[model samples]
Target: MDAFYASVEQLDHPEWRGKPLVVGGNEARGVVAAASYEARKFGIHSAMSSALAAKKCPHLIFARPRFERYKEISLQIRDIFYEYTDLVEPLSLDEAFLDVTENKVGLKSAILIARQIRAKIKEKTGLNASAGVSYNKFLAKTASDLNKPNGQAVILPEEAEAFLEKLPIGKFFGIGKVTAEKMQKLGIHNGKDLKEYSLQFLTKKFGKSGLHYYNIVRGIHLSEVQPHRVRKSLSAENTFEKDLISLQEMEAHFYPIFEEVVRRIEKSGIKGRTVTVKIKFSDFSQQTRSKTLEQYPNADQLWEVGLELLRQEEIPKPVRLLGLGISNLNLTEEQVYFGEQLKIPFHISNGKG
Candidate 1:
C-alpha cells in the first residue's frame, strides 16, 4: 500500500493517475493525509499542513479521505491474507506482518505466497499491491518497500546480513529524523557503521531503542508478528498555528480537542483513569501535566480535569504544541457511574488564575 490513501484515490479515479493528488482537507487548518508520488516530487508529504502542501505544489489536487472505502478494501485484503496464515498482524489499512512459518496453503516458499497474495489483491480490488518475503518481520517490512506500486521483493535468511550491511540507517524502522541526526553525529551513518558500536554503548545512549538498533544491525531482530494487539489508548495532539503565551489562549484552543476526545471516548466505549495534557515550548522542550481522577470519566469530565492540569502549569515560554491523552483505562462496571457523573451538568473547575 504505497501512498495508500492517495493510491486509493488514483485507483478509483483513473484520470488522477501519474498526477499530483493529495488526500486530506483542503482548508486552512487541514493536514495532508496522503500524497501521491507525483506530489512527493514537489516536496509534499503526509502530516504536512494542507495549506503548506498547496503552497509547495500549486497544482496539487486535494481530495478528502474516504475512510469507509479504505476500510472495506482493508477487510478484503485481510480475507486474502487468511488464505495463507492466521498470524497476520495489521500495521495499518495497507500493510501487515504475516507469519507464514506454517501457512495453511503449505506453500514451500514465502516469496511465492507473497506473489500470489499480491496478484489476488490486484485481481479482487482492481488495484496494485506490493509484497515482501523474508525470514523475519524487520527484513520483510524493509523488503516490502524496495519495490512499490505492484512490486515484490524477497530477502533470504542467508542474505540478511549483507542486506542490512548495505542499507542506510535512515531506512530502519524507529530511525526518524531526530534519531538519524543523532546517529550521524555518533559516526553511525549506515548499518555498517551502526554495527561498530557495542550493544551496551548504544543502550546507554538511546535507552531501549538502542538494543533494537544493535539487533537490526546484525539482522537478528526477534520481534514477533503479533495478531491484533489491543489498543491501550486513543488520543490526538496538535501543534497550534501560532504559539500561545497565555492560559486563556490555551483554554480556548483546548476546548475543541477536549470535546472531540470525549466524543471519541464515548464512541469507542473506553474508560480512562488518567488524563494528561502535553505541552511543548517554542524551543522544543516538552512537559506533561496530568491527573488521576477518583473515578473513570467521559468526555465532559475528562476535559474538565484536562483544563485543571493546564491551569497549574507555569508558562515559561510560548507553547507550540498542545496534546491530550487518556490512559490507565477502566473497562469495568465503575466506568458506568463515571459516565453518568460526566453527563450530569455541573460547574467545571477552571483551575485557572
Candidate 2:
C-alpha cells in the first residue's frame, strides 16, 4: 500500500487526487498519521507534528482517518496473499512477509509470485503495492522499500553481500537514530563496517541485540515467516490541541482514549494483564508507567489502573500527548502464560502509527 491512509482518502474523495494530503488531526499538537507523496515532496511524513507539517506545506489537505475502510481493504489484500501462500507474516495492516519457498500454485519463481500478488492487489483493491523477493526476511524487507508505489525489487543471493556492504548502517532495518550514532562513533558506518566486528564483540557491546545485528549484516536472518503471529497489545492515544496543565484536565482526555482501547480489546477478543500509561511532555520528553495485574483486567479495571498511574505522575510540565495500553496477552486458558512483556507503542491515528 502506498501512502495507505492518505491514499485511501484520495480514492474515496476524488477531489483530493494529485493534491498534497494528510490523514490525521489537523490540530496544534496532533501528529501526522500518514502523508501522500505530494505531501512528502514538501518534507511531510508520519509521526511529524501536524502543525509542523502545515508549516512545511501551507496548502496541505487534512482528512480524518477511516480505519474500518482501511481494514476492509487490508483484508482484501491479505486474501490475495492467501491465494499464493499460507506463510504470511503481517507486520502491520498494510505490510506483510510471505514465504513462497513452496506456494499454493506451485510457482517456482518467487519473483513471479510477488509480481502476481502485486497485480492482484491492484486489480482487486484499485490500489498499488510494492514487493521484494529474496531468500531471507531482511533482504526481502530491505528490497521492498528500494522501490516505490507499484514497483518491485529482487535481491539475488549472490548479490546480497555486495549489495548490503554498499548500504549505509542507518538504512539497515533495526538500526535507529540512536543506534546509528553509536555505530558511526565505533567506525561501523555500513554493512561492511558492521561485518568487521566479531559476534563476541557485538554481543558484548550491544547485549542480546548485537547477536541479531551480527547475523543480519551477513544476510543470515533465519527467522521464519510466521502466519499465526499472536498479537501482543492494542492501544490508542491522542495529541492535545492545547497542552493539558493539570491532572484533572489530563483525566478528561484519558476517558475517551480508554473507551477506544476497550472497544478495540473487545473487538479483538483478547485480554491482557498489564496496563501502561504514556505521557509526552510539552518539551517532547516522554515517560511511561506500567503495572502488571494478578489477573487480566477488563475495561473498567484497566481504566482504574490507568487513572492511578496518571495520579502518580508529577506534572511539572504540561502534557502534549497521552496514551494508555494493555499488554501481557493471553489467547486461551490452556495456553501457557509466557510472561512475555509487550509494549504497544502509541499510534498517531486509528490505522498506522
Candidate 3:
C-alpha cells in the first residue's frame, strides 16, 4: 500500500487526487497519521504535528481517518495473500510479510508472486502497492521501500552481500535514531562498517541486540516469518498542544487516555497484569513507571494503578505527552487455539539465515 490512508481518501474522493493531502485529526493537538506523496514534497510526514504540516504546506488538504474502511480493505488484501500462501504475518493494517516459498499456486519465483499479488490488489481495490522479494524478512522489508508507489524490487541471494554492504545503517530495519547515532559514533556508518565488528565486541557494547546487528549486516537473519504473532502490549498516548503545568491538567488528560486503552483492551479480548504510565517532559525526555499485579487487572483496577504511578513521580516537570499502557498480556482460549492452528514450519531460506 502507498500512503495508505491518504491514498484511500484520494481513491474514494476523486477530486483530491494529485493534490497534497493529509489524513488525521485537524485539531491543534492533532498529529499527521498519513500524508500523500504530494504532501511529502513539502516535508510533511506521518507523526508530524498537523499544525506544523499545515505550516509546511499551506494548501495541504486534511481528512479524518476512516479506519473502518481501511480495515475492510486490509481484509480484502489479506484474502488475496491467502490465495497464494497461508504464511502471512500482518505488521499493520497496510503492510504484511508473506512467505510464498510453498505457495498454493506452486509458484517457483517469489518475484512473480509479488508482482501478481500487487496486480491483484490493484484489480480488487483500485489502489497501488509496492513489493519486495528476498530470501529473508529483513531484506524483503528493506527492499520494499527502495521503490515508491506501484513498484517492486527483488534482492537475490547472490546480490544480498553487496547490496547490504553499501546500505546506510540508518536505513536498516529496526535501527532507530538513537541506535544509529550510537553506531555512527563508533565509526559504523554503513553495513560494511558494521560487519567489521566481531560478534563478541558487538554484544559487549550493545548487549544481546549487538548479535542481531552483527548477523544482519552479514546478510544473516534466522528469525522465521511468524504468522500468528501475538500482541504483547496495548497503549494509547496523547501529545498536548501546550505543556501540562499542573497535576490537575495531567489527570484530566490521563483519564480519557486510560478509557481509550481500556476500550481497546476489551475490544481485543485481552488483558494484562502490568499497568504503565508514560510521561514525556516538555524537553522531550521520557519516563515510565510500571506495576505488575498478581492477575490481569480490570479497567477500574488498571485506572487505580495508573493514577498511583502518576502520583509517584518524584520530580514532576511540565509534560508534553502522557500515555497509559498494559503489558504481560494473556490471550483468550480462542486466541491460543488460533495461534496453534496458524503455527507452521519455517521455509528454508536460500541465503544464509
Using all chains and alpha carbons, the TM-scores for the candidates as numbered come to 0.82, 0.90, 0.88
In model 2, what lDDT does residue 273 have?
90
Better of 1 and 2 by lDDT: 2
Give the alpha carbon lDDT tens digit for every residue of 215-285 in model 1: 98788888898875656565666666667888899899878667767777777778788899888887668
lDDT measured at residue 292 in model 2 versus the true structure, 0 to 100: 94
Off-target runs (Cα >4 Å) in candidate 3 are 25-28, 240-243, 332-353
Looking at model 1, which ten-residue stretch has the lowest summed lDDT?
Answer: 336-345
Clashing pairs in 1: 262-299
lDDT of 2 by residue, 159-249 (tens): 9999999899999977898999999999999999999999999999999999999988888999998777565666778777778998899
Ranking the candidates on lDDT from highest down gives 3, 2, 1
lDDT of 3: 0.84
- Model 2 stretches astray by more than 4 angstroms: 298-300, 333-353
Q: What lDDT score is found at residue 160 in candidate 2?
A: 93
Candidates 1 and 3 compared: the better one by lDDT is 3
